[model samples]
Target: MAPNDFDNSIHDFDTTDDGSGPEPSPELWRHTPFTAFVAGEDTRAVYVRDHLPVLMPSFVVDFALRCTEFRSLPGHIARYAESQAWGSAEIEALRSWQRKLVRAGLFISRTELYTRAAAIRESNATPAKIGVIGFSTAGDRADLLLRALGSFAENVQTHGRAVDFLVADSAVDAGHRGRLRGLAGERAADLGVTLRYLGEQEKRLFATELIRRSQCRPEAVEFALFDPFGAGSAGGANRNALMLHEAGSVLAAVADDVLCELASTDSGDFKLALFSDTDPYDRWVFADRADALEAVSFEPRDYLAEQEKLLGRNLGDLLAGVPVNEVNVRKLGLTFLHLLDSGAARIRTTHLGHAGNPAIPTSSFYAPHKGTERELAAEAEIRYRASFASRGALARLATPSVGDGTVSPGMAIGLDHRELLPPFFPVLPAEDLVFGATMGACCPGALSGHLPLCLRHETNGDNAPLHPGEINRARQGSVFEFSQILRAIMAGHQPATQADTTARMQKLGRYICEFAAQPTLDFREALHRIVLTHESQKIMALEHALFTEIDAPEFWRRDIRDFLDHSRDRMQHEDFDIPYELKAGRTNEENRILMQKLIASYGRLLEDWPAIVAAAWDLRSEGKQFSASAKAD
Candidate 1:
């Protein structure tokens, strides 16, 4: 049946006053289970139900199995059947059985959900006020800081896992935070953007959220790691490799497989300097969890400016040392997909219905802010139309012989010549293959030395030109007109079917005469001639030699020589611009070269007359590349 035969339903809910009572609520459109076991809730179900079955019958196997006891379905019982009919009783019974099977497990199915729960768990493991890492650039340096902070969270002094999201939020002294904020603001200003740098309040909220979501607890540590450089600090503490690895790992753990990159940082040595502005130890205070350790002694600024420059360079060098792995990024995406759901399902479901269902409200007041029912339906129709149009275009370029016997394997459609062909030709595989052979013969090959062989490619100077195959099917048909005339002339001598033969002869004669009147070959005429020409000259020569040359060896040898020379001269003619006929393209020249080589094989007959002549009869029977060198006595 054609695609147009399907009973397609276009659900365009009438918003105007038709007053057919309240239409099915958009909630009913909530994707629901078609089968209890398989989540008929997914979008794949909609595709299978509405489209795939019509296009690809093979996909129906999964659906059939899901809905029926497909394995037990009866096969044809030829022995029991007196005639070809299966009978109405059997058909009815089958339909009833199929209906029962479909309804048996039609609803109340377990729903499949993406396993993104790990993401929530990871987010809760961090202890600090919220950690903010820039998605692209600041990511790497932010990663380093997180890892160093993770080590501290893991230490006995700081039961790292006790913190939420498995990350230790670094506690920066007020002076440092202020400096970082100032730097970030300045950079943001230079870039002409408003800066909302993380302050105490934002940090506290972020940390609280992380703690609330923690799934696991680990060992804690002493100090937190911070990417002061990433924060836009021109001269401050620098983050290094160890910090990045730890931070990256923790982030990955919390992200539940979301891919992340490290950000850049500045070079500076770690200093436990106590300043009157904001003493690091004095400013430190735990607002919610855990106690602080005893203060260690700090050194005063001795080589502040020098150390800052050296540290900046060292930090840059350290960051430059770590190369980002692209494979890691790719792996991260795959991991994320894996974490979503099992992707190896043979069959899947999709939702196509409107909003009402609580399970899948595809169209709610808030969801899919596209438009009204009519508009959406129009859009769907447009997509469907566009898909079919593109499919047709691809079919044209990819498979011109879609319905013809010549359909290639790459084409989805398969054609049987027995079912479709002109009534004039016999419905035989050999006959169809012969048609292909005839087409193939028109174009000459580089290896085959004949005008009617495969195509050949030839180079001129910088550019190469293709010599077209000799067999033009239209021309061959015209030549067949001439051949039919010859066939009639031969049939005249025979007594059987003389009148019928004569009429055919007359028809053929008229065709040939009409074609002959038009002195030049039309494109179609040229094509026909090439197709029918075959290896007629060679076969004729061999046949004539067997009959006449058996009586005169020397005479036969001389005739062969003359034939070879004449053919060679004709093929080698410099004025023969076969490229013009071929119409040059990338592969045209190659085909022309094939033709030249094939025609050039006749030169081999002259080189080794007896051998080539001997090989000629068996050559067509074998599938191989063959050539003749030169004529020899």
Candidate 2:
């Protein structure tokens, strides 16, 4: 048999033989006594036997599970039965009983297998810090609540981490009653995380905490809160009514305070993730209160959306902030830190405690335009321009008119383009303006153009242009209009690939020669294309690899292939336009980096020095090829 064909039969179907009807084997169960079940022997039995336990309950569950078309195999049936610890003919009897229960609405409408699996999870789980409070109802609908409580109880026994139970509303019913109380009891007994059910009372507690913290520590706290409740009207309560009055303001303020307080705590900065059904809770409250809280509503049908959003938001915020000098960020793991720091942005804070100045304040220090929005706009514009100019800005006026606009004298600009800069730019404007202007003025010689404001002359050169706003605008337009010319001449990939690496490389080689044939290169355009091409390639490669199965191992390769094949019909474009796989192939530069690191870490692991030398040289050759190809294509 061929190497790839060795396991050809592994997934093949055999329909040649007649199938037998489903039935429980009684002999399998008779071997075990009832006493064995009570001692937790059942859990051990499945592992020891390495097969399905032949018993009543488990058999019933497996049979019901087998009702799904794909689970008709006898081995699957046996394993499913064993996982549930079922034995004997009684398994079938129990299965029948469960089916009847489902029909009667005593058990859930789903298959018995689902309930059993859930029950198993309940039995084995330890208390977790968070709970899922989904759409609620009474009676049979209480099953989810019970399952949640059971998970908490089971896990909390030996754990110290806090746990929270969830309560969410669903379309099938109203909210649960006394559910939070019940969950709270279970949590307390287990000494796990507290179970909180948000309501008026909870809101009050959160608000009070917020007010207390803010008044005491001032800027020490901050929050990013999303709508804590479901989205809709606030039930039409009179704004002046005691219950509704100040609710939005009070809640928002409290949320903000709590955020700051939690962040200030020695334990570590923490974020509160919340979902609400009311307008104030979801919008007005969090928006006005916790500037830091990044709250998103749970989708109409998704009970856990809030939970997912919370985890994502909190993790991202924590990771991106200043590294706690005293804390071990590595302990949280890079991925977790990345999630916290780079995920959905929560907010960015600087100056630890200056009662943060709004990035866009409505008022100004001067009169007239002082309070108008235009002042804020101008202030913001200055920063914006400063940033775009390489954060190197200083006041400068355009030279008045150049002989051919080659260099205008009216552009008497500050050393830095600082004056032209908008405040939005983060870098200091004054210093940059001077440095850039000076550099542009002199290359290798004495002075070229008159220094608008000479670095040494405290007052000379006053005739230079006083405004460069027009110059700035002209420069920007020149860039856009000549972008293509720039790409052809100036743009080139760095550390060019070697020739003869791949067909792709050969094409790029040709493209580069064609481009270079043109006369003079626009240095500015070249620089821009180099950046653009590299970025475009990076994005394309990442997306291509993520959507392909080219590098996935055997275990998941088949599934991935199937998914790709299935999705092919939906693709709007053809293969020629699709990006090639971005595999960390043996010859890839990124992979080479890893290899070098490995060699450094375990130098002794390389048994042949000559082989290593040859490989490195080969890689360098390949890189040259790649670079040449990039230029062509």
Top TM-score model: 2
lDDT tens per residue, model 2, 195-267: 3333333324433443352332211111101112221111111011111111211100000000111111112
Residue-level lDDT tens digits of model 1 in 254-284: 1111111111111111111101111011011
Can you give the lDDT of residue 243 in candidate 1?
18
What total of clashing residue pairs does each candidate reach?
110, 111
For model 2, the superposed segments whose C-alpha errors exceed 4 Å read: 1-174, 183-200, 208-633
User: What would the TM-scores of all predictions be?
Assistant: 0.16, 0.18
In model 1, the worst 10-residue window by lDDT is 446-455
Worst lDDT run of 10 residues, candidate 2, spans 250-259
Model 2 Cα displacement at 480 (Å)?
34
Q: What is the TM-score (0 to 1) of candidate 1? A: 0.16
